[model samples]
Target: MQPPLIERNVADVCRTVLDDATEDVLAVGPSPTVVDGLVAMLADRENGPSVRLLATESVLKASVSEFTDASVIADLVADESLSLRTSAERLDGPLLVTDERVVSLVTTDERTAGLATDDAAFVDAAREEYTDRWADAESFRLRTPPLSRVQESLEREFDEELAADFERMRIALAEADGHLDEVDISLLAAARNEALLYDISTWGEGVGIASRATFSRKKTRLEEGGLIETEKVPIDVGRPRLRLLLGDDHLRGIDADEVVSVAAELLAAARQ
Candidate 1:
């Protein structure tokens, strides 16, 4: 074992370790900057050293913004050179292990401090510890469209569909003349956002319809008119909760944006 070499700048140590690495590179941290540096190193090689990245969910999300060239990351993954994963638990500090010999510990406090060494015992212990953590981590891969892009696409699609449904609801409300109120609209809007069913009391409170009796009466009317439906959701103890959901017909025919917008307005008013 050798004495660890201290460096004032973590970035310099990282660059040196990565530059000298030949066989493998293992990085664990929540630092977007470090991740970007690794990504750049990988991109520069046609066949870089096999790399494994372990990060927390927050770090991965931050990396999405930091590394705008998502396609490059995807390319590295596709070539089987880079493997990325995320841990639910937060890591203590940043570490970079290269070629089973060199190790770099990156620090962000006071200054960008780092320690590098080729100590066999220290490197082995760090590798073993990281291996265990890696086993429990969830794998992440940067796809062509990427997960964030897919989420944005889904949101846009939902918004467009909801807008169309709101137009229909507007006409229906005008004809009914206060028969269906803001509560009904709020419930419908809530249904559009991926929650198909909700407990009456909880959902009511969440949507700003506080009065139980009023909410119940409105719920009955909506159910009678085929706007929403209810079912019993089984619980481990006590009576089953009454779960409210959009009626099948309403879900199929209505656009969701208008209902959501109206619901938001009603909720805002309630708060004020």
Candidate 2:
């Protein structure tokens, strides 16, 4: 069955507000679309507005690509600064991120991003409540990306076959520490059948781990799923040497429920 049509009028409002605001505009929220739209809106010199944004650290980091030179608006007490705010109840839709006074509000709704709201009649009243808290709020600077760095990060790493596995590994282990760089998991998979212990030095010597033919074949298998990617890191002398992750057949012995339980435990701990 098809779901009911829910109109997203907030996007239009956001577009209108960005299109109209002349001076500095403040906004806050976790919506990437809002950041993207606002950044694009402000990037224009002729028709664009001056947009300032506030958001949670996670959202800010994830949407780093969308911002211009954003500084942390620490003066939450000041009417002109932007800061993050969340609602008591976790609502289904996006909330308004801006007030007429000075700061912006960030909410869960995707549509309400850069838009002005009819609900902002008490902007002054809300500012009073915010001042009490902003004085105690700690500030951190927003990270800006260099254009050169952005372009460098977008290039492909390994060939298609191994690329997909590396990409999936990165996604699955995104929160895992020490997993930042791209890896060719197929190389590890190739080492799986061999008894040869390949060290980083040996790998540098051009004789280590999986045979080139074997690794190449494994890459082919991974490519069948889809092209995956990760940043390639040269495994220099490491605590643990690189090897291809053993494929699905190795996981056949474990019950699926065990995996689910382990994942649930990790998630629960993460929330805490």
- TM-score of every candidate relative to the true structure: 0.46, 0.33
152-250, model 1: which lDDT tens digit per residue? 443353464443443345345434434344446545654444333334334445433345666677666656655566778788999776666666542
Q: For candidate 2, report its TM-score.
A: 0.33
- What is the Å distance of residue 111 in model 1 from its true position? 9.0
Q: For candidate 2, write residues 1-74 as lDDT tens digits.
A: 11222224334445555444445444544366655444444343344433444355555565542222221122
Clashes (backbone N, CA, C under 3 Å), per candidate, total 4, 15
- lDDT (Cα atoms) of all candidates against the true structure: 0.58, 0.36
Name the top TM-score candidate.
Answer: 1
